[model samples]
Target: MSAFLSARRLALLATRCPRRTLSTTPRWSADPWPLPHTAQHLSNTQTPSDIPPPTPIPRPGESEETLRARLVYQSRKRGTLESDLLLSTFARDHLGKMDETELKEYDKLLDEPDWDIYYWATEGRSPPERWAKSSVLEKLTIHAKNEGKVVRRMPPL
Candidate 1:
């Protein structure tokens, strides 16, 4: 059946990229501007570069939101989800704190489901206040841990 062949092809594609592909996320650098801004402003510029800039992908559907929001409703407010608690503990307990790039990445995740969250979580930075209530932060932590990016931290003496 066509469905069976489609499923097989999907499996093959998943295997091709062992890690979640954040192809647009190069190592954060001071040199180049962030792609979201560039992509939005591209049409106004006089000289478009030879290589097209990355475009900001829109959320897939009504389901769009943070992993936390996807999993649980904040209005229920039975305190933070267990997953969020765990993520906070890890960042507060160790990871030596997040740098500017990591913080920006975390903030961006709250505003949007940009792939930047994966890098921020794996890099061990906490999302800032504007995004503190988001499910995207939860999803970022979950994915980073599930992908084997976790590290145990010793309590500060």
Candidate 2:
């Protein structure tokens, strides 16, 4: 009977203690994946903010002012602040000089995933072949190299 009680207690302790240990040591400390430096972990330590504001979209046949506003909003609201600042500054600086076709291309580039854009911009990783020759992306490369705060030369894979 003492042995049975001891085994039961051991099983209960095993279940509780492992979870406490694991929770204290985050797995990312060992994993090499490039985890985004976002505000996700802060929610546990700080009060959560409200849902992000909606992105403005240009209406069909909208005025240039409307399109400019839409693009500015999109540029400023990327998944990470690094991408946000890079894109928004580039857009606000150059969009005024772009013709309608150039504006369309720039708008299409904004639809790309933030990780891909961030990697391409800050690390000089070439974008997919489809957009490799895009003038807009070329301009973005220049903008990122000149203005980005977190630029790094990722070691050759």
lDDT of 2 by residue, 79-127 (tens): 7766787788787678889888788787878877676677667543456
Candidate closest to the true structure, highest TM-score: 2
Each model's C-alpha lDDT?
0.43, 0.69
Q: Which stretches of candidate 2 lie over 4 Å from their true place?
A: 1-59, 147-157
Worst 10 residues of 2 by lDDT: 40-49
Give the per-residue lDDT of model 1 (tens digit) for 1-157. Answer: 9999999999998899677756776585443543322443232322323544344445444322353242232112223233244444444432234443444344344343222343345533444455566554555556457557555332232
lDDT of 2 at 19: 56
In model 1, which regions exceed 4 Å deviation? 1-80, 93-95, 112-157
What is residue 91's positional error in candidate 2, in angstroms? 1.4
